[model samples]
Target: MGSCEVYPQTIQHSPNGRFVVVCGDGEYIIYTAMALRNKSYGSAQEFVWAHDSSQYAIREGNSVVKIFKNFKEKKTFKPGFGADCIFGGFLLGVRSNSGLAFYGWETSDLIRRVEILPKHIFWSDSGELVCIATEESFFVLRFLMERVTTAQESREMLTEDGIEDAFEVLGEVQEVVKTGLWVGDCFIYTSSVNRLNYYVGGEIITIAHLDRTMYLLGYIPKDDRLYLGDKELNIISYSLLLSVLEYETAVMRKDFNTADRVLPTIPLEQRTRPLSVMLFKNNCLISVLLNYLTRLSILLQFSGEQIV
Candidate 1:
């Protein structure tokens, strides 16, 4: 096989057989289970790759850590100003800004400690000891290691001006009233002054007028579905873009005009209130927390027999 060339601004690999490389400009590569199963490329902006590559992690400014047989990106163990190191099946991490934060592969949540250790660090698949540096020399240890083989995939082409056509809308959005528009698995969710609308397949179907009572808080898309969470702890789940209007009317016909109040929710007491939505386990809906917040959050899973 021809050796693949990757211009990763930052690169990392784990001994367990997984790879995570991020372009300095803002692109990421992940070796996922499905990518390995089909022997294809797995690099979607969304964290929907299949589990089995041995390590689960992503690199933004900070890394989101996940470990499981199945690829569910929700088990982000440590967030915020800290470092991590893993070796011999033992995962370790340190926290900061106030509190003890430590964890491993066994526990779903992280534990905090009183003292900090400088030597306990995680190793990468290349047998290289890697640690995040704050200034020029002081290294904070964080990040477990895994190994993964990569198959080159087509990437977005950028123009000479260092811009992509996809991001052009951002300029237009800023011209407006700072409105937000997002694409979901099955529909599009948008927010403007006092109004929330849902569109499926390019057609407007559902409309909610907040009337200055409440503001739109967040939305999450997953597996051809979208979950909307508002400021009032109301979580409304919608599937199939064409079905959004019908679903909302049926669920809130009695109080559609008034602000949402009686909706069920995934617990968010331990973490900061979510201002945005992200895809969780099995394409389920969940709120996105700040990268460094100490909160109680878990990947919401679907229990249907059809789920893989």
Candidate 2:
């Protein structure tokens, strides 16, 4: 048709650029490589594109989980309780009012379910343990190895151990705004501790940005870089290079922690500035700089070749 109608939720091009996925408040629409359209699900609280881009998952507020492959229904999971879900590889982590649960793809079976105060959940690459977050708390849960042998099995696992109060309750957990979570070789989330914090995880590391005006946008695990944009139109990148203990102590969780700098720059000095930034590859940064006042967009490319 005529340039495919723009969506209100959010539209994202797959990393490979073969497909485009749109997320409405409670729905997701998938457009194929050739621009074929498919209606996936409805009443979803959130949506995540699979790493391979072959399928995507929807987290329904009613605790009904669904996944579609090639625009066909692959599987459906119902937690039996209202829960929020996050995905990694073939694993799905679901957060509920009572606790958290994990499930495997293909087979709609439970991996592990913990009955405790639930918050946010993150599964490492290995998928052995998961990090859970609450108001101002964080905890880890280890999966029983013997249970999750494969998807063909029953797919039930036990929780080994977890923390009740993971970190020191600093800032107002209610006032703390959660943008999103980044997972890979490192983890960076837009969360406010005392102010706004950029958490870098890997080899036990975490970094917090004290500036209230700054917000974390994205993270590239391969390069260990985090992209931050401020209301002042300053786009900066922070590369992870130190350990978490180097800034905070094991006994006390301090928000006044600072890691070493990587590289900081503004993508758009003119116009109203870039509303978004994407890391394509080394030296080549893709930015969608906007001038709302004039209602224009300029795709800016920042590279070393042009600097000289």
Q: Pick the candidate with the highest lDDT.
A: 2
What lDDT would each prediction earn against the true structure? Answer: 0.32, 0.48
Model 2: residue 117 alpha-carbon error in angstroms = 5.1
139-256 per-residue lDDT for model 1 (tens digits): 2122222211111112333222211221111001111112233332122333345445442222233355554433333344334344555567676644433233232322322332
Weakest 10 consecutive residues of candidate 1 by summed lDDT = 167-176
Give residue 38's lDDT in candidate 1 (0 to 100). Answer: 22
TM-score of each: 0.26, 0.54
Determine the C-alpha RMSD for candidate 1 after optimal superposition of all C-alphas: 22.2
Task: Give the TM-score comparing model 2 with the true structure, all chains together.
Answer: 0.54
| C-alpha RMSD values across all candidates | 22.2, 14.2
Rate residue 244 of model 1 by lDDT.
35
